[model samples]
Target: MNTLQKWLGPVLFCTCLGGGLTLGWSATTDLNKKRSSEVAVLQNALYDQECGSCHFAYQPGWLPARSWDKIMTGLKDHFGENATLAAEPQRQLTDWLRVHAADHAQGGKIQKMVRSIPAQATPIRITEIPYFQKEHRKLPLRTWKENPQVRSLSHCATCHPQAKEGSFDEHAVRIPNFGPWKD
Candidate 1:
């Protein structure tokens, strides 16, 4: 009985270790493939001129076309700020956002965000996406509300210096008042 117990323990440990290694390798491969490419930054002169002037110019791929439409229609009360653009610029920006929306594009976190959302949901804010929320679940509430540099989750660039380039790789994250993120 003693001999059997000793053998069984090592055998079970070996099996579990092998299984964990296989799963970890496969997960890394899948994640690497999905995030290999970065979404193109917002390059439209009008988009940058109007939106970038106020805050970081979020890439259109962050949300779906319906969300963009909702945002454009509500420009008069845009997050409590009146961001009403002229008729022509509004139309152009709306068209640009739609064409590059998450559902219309491929690659990276944007694709994951699109898949995480339900068909009925039309989230105007990137922070409202399930994937974004899941990624931030480890963060303390004070990190978003009390941290002056990271006053809100909408301040993407506060923690993500490469946010402007549409690169949100976890390896690039640097939380303010804290150190590098560990996942």
Candidate 2:
């Protein structure tokens, strides 16, 4: 075989292999339209259960819908948390969880922007994100309680523009009490 044939052959083979792997990864990604839509609709119904009933459900696609399924199906024994759900209802929750499972989900806005940071670092919440903390670090925690509407992170939408869209985008940030504070 010619020198060009040998060099091009391995490169093409690797590219195809890499592309196939990437396609497979995307196939398993939790952001698929069908599953995400199902999760979006269920999000509202989740509030009907109880306050903190669905804490952080909309924060990030943290858990792949599948992992969400496992968690809900075993709600009564939910890790260390005291959450619970009925068998039939758990089934419904499971179906939704499968699509929005933590494994496949993006945790929060910080995660979306982590590409610019060190991957070895642990993920952080909206309130814990560096840029976020830097901006709101001056505020007192008690201030939030005194004004229920301002309860610390209750106003996440004040900055994360996508909070209304059921997603978080760092570029959309505009901290509340600073600008466009009204949610």
Worst 10 residues of 1 by lDDT: 31-40
What is the Cα-based lDDT of residue 81 in candidate 2? 67
lDDT of 2 at 114: 34
Off by over 4 Å in 2: 1-60, 65-70, 73-82, 102-155, 180-183
Local accuracy of candidate 2 as per-residue lDDT tens digits, 35-87: 44322324546434532444534432433343344445555665466677656
Q: Write the per-residue lDDT of candidate 1 for residues 1-183, one digit (tens) a residue.
A: 999997999999999999999999999886666444666665788888999999989888788999999999999999999999999999899999999888855656677788899999888888999998998998887776788778898999898889887787789899988868887
Q: Alpha-carbon error at 82 in model 1, in Å? A: 0.8
Choose the strongest candidate by lDDT: 1
Worst 10 residues of 2 by lDDT: 109-118
